[model samples]
Target: MKIGLYFGSFNPIHIGHLVIANHLVEHSDLDQIWFVVTPHNPFKKKSSLLDNYQRLEMVYRATKDYPKLQPSDIEFNLPQPNYTINTLVYLQEKHPDYKFSLIMGEDNLKSFHKWKNYELILENHHIYVYPRLSKGHVETQFDNHKKIHHIDAPIMELSSTFIRSAIKAGKNIQPMLPQHVWEYLDEMNFYK
Candidate 1:
């Protein structure tokens, strides 16, 4: 089975995240997309993040109806400050039958070199790069690499930060989040 690993903190799952996952599943060769909820992103601050289990639950609520989109809590049991390379290695060892690829935004590709063992990731797995809101193009050294592919997925400017801010201000964020996720957020009074 060919699986695409879409890694993120998903502090709260939003429609933008869903759109990208759906787009990739429908348009790309990937059979399924696993939303790997990172316990702690090495590049992001942990203080602002919700509990790993809480974030994972939100992901489950948001993607419950989507057959191709699945939430993974694999990072929760792994070491803190989750590194993509380590997770990929572990996943390969555990699920050797599955062929895994990475799904990332062009913006992340710009900083790809800074990731731990990035070269190893490129050597072992393919990367599907979706466009994002950015002023300039990503200048990657692997532009012509066979393992890297540029996909024409829609670019959504909506972010978890914007959603959190809206919730704090008591603004209507219904359009930005999945229905179940919004209901869950409202019931839990998250980010308030």
Candidate 2:
């Protein structure tokens, strides 16, 4: 099986996430898309993130209906300050038959060189890149890298940050979220 690992905090899973994952899975050869919910991202602040289980629950709610999309808590058990290389290695070890690729934004690709053992990662797995409205430049080497593919997926500017802020400000962020995720957040009174 060809699985695309779409890693994120999913502080709350929103529509933008679905659209991109759906588009990629449906358009590409990937058989499934896994939303690898990170327990801790070295680049982001831990305090701002919700509990791991809560975030995972939201992901479950958002992706339940989509058979092609599934949520994974693989990072939850791994050592904190999670790194992509470690997860990739662990996954490869467990699922030898599965061809796993990365699903990341073009902005992340720009900083791909800075990741741990990035060279090794590039050697082993393919990376599917989506467009993002961020400012930065991709390294010249990655521009034509065979393992890195830049797909013309829709540019979804809606962010979990924006949704969280809106909910805190008592704004209606329902439309931005999957119905069940919104209901889950509302029922739990999260981000308020």
Candidate 3:
């Protein structure tokens, strides 16, 4: 089976995340997509992040109805300061029969070279990139472009930052997030 690892700090899983997962499953050859909720992303700041377990629960709630999309807290068990290479290696070892690839937005693709062991990752796995504002920049730099498949998935303007800000401003973030995720965040009074 081929699994696409949609790695992210799902502070509170939103509809945007679900849209990408659904698109990948429906349009691509991928068999499943695992929302690998990271405790800490090396490239991102930690101050804005919610608790890993809480974030994982939000992802779980968001993806519960989709059998092809799963919420995985795999990085939580790994060492702190989770790196994609480390997670990939561990996952490869654990599930020897299944193949894994990366599913990321074009914005992330631009700075992907700076990631730890990025060359090895590019060499070993296929990267499914969705078109964002940074697509042109990434396409220009990458010489071996065949490894990257640019997908025309729904472009979502909604982000975790927007969600957080909405909650902080006492605005309605219910529409920004999945129904169950919104319920969970409201119940916990998260981001307040």
Candidate number achieving the greatest TM-score relative to the actual structure: 1
> lDDT (0-100) at residue 94 of candidate 3?
98
lDDT of 2 by residue, 82-172 (tens): 7899999999999999999999998788778899999999999999999887666546569989988888899999989998889889999
Task: Name the regions of candidate 1 deviating beyond 4 angstroms.
Answer: 41-47
Give candidate 2 regions above 4 Å deviation: 41-45, 134-139
What is the C-alpha lDDT profile of model 1 across 83-119, one tens digit per residue?
Answer: 8999999999999999999999998888899999999
TM-score of each: 0.94, 0.94, 0.92
CA lDDT scores, all candidates in order: 0.91, 0.91, 0.87
lDDT of 3 by residue, 70-106 (tens): 9998888898776899999999999999989999988
Count of backbone clashes for each model?
A: 0, 0, 0
lDDT of 3 at 21: 85
Error of 3 at 73 (Å): 0.9
Give the per-residue Cα lDDT of candidate 3 at 156.
83
